[model samples]
Target: MSTADDLKKLRLKAQIGITTVLGLVSIYILLTQPDNSSLQKWAIGTLGIIVGYWLK
Candidate 1:
């Protein structure tokens, strides 16, 4: 593969990793912080996933 192709693959992987981490963190907050607002977290997490999909 070309250098550009390799870079693109690396960037795609990073994006996926970041989105996954955001989703997991949101879930953790929702489960652990009962007093905190979960709706906001859910919205942020969903947005992250959506953005990632859009990027791909």
Candidate 2:
């Protein structure tokens, strides 16, 4: 593959990794913390995933 294709694959992998981490963290927070801020964190995490996909 070309360098450009390699770079695109790397970028996509990074984005997926970040989104997965954020989603896991958000789920952890929601499950462990029964508070108001968990909701906000979850929302932010969801938004991050959306924006990540949008950017991709």
Model 2, C-alpha of 18: deviation from truth (Å): 0.3
TM-score of model number 2: 0.64
Output the lDDT of residue 18, model 2.
Answer: 79
lDDT of 2 by residue, 1-56 (tens): 57998999999899779777777776666677756785867766686776777686
Clashing pairs in 2: none
Candidate 1, after superposition: displacement of residue 22 in Å? Answer: 1.3
Clash count of each predicted structure: 0, 0
Model 2 spans with C-alpha error above 4 angstroms: 38-56
TM-score of each: 0.59, 0.64
Extract clashing residue pairs from model 1.
Answer: none
Candidate 1 residue-wise lDDT at 43: 54
lDDT of 1 by residue, 1-50 (tens): 57998999999899779877777776666667655476656756677776
Worst 10 residues of 2 by lDDT: 34-43
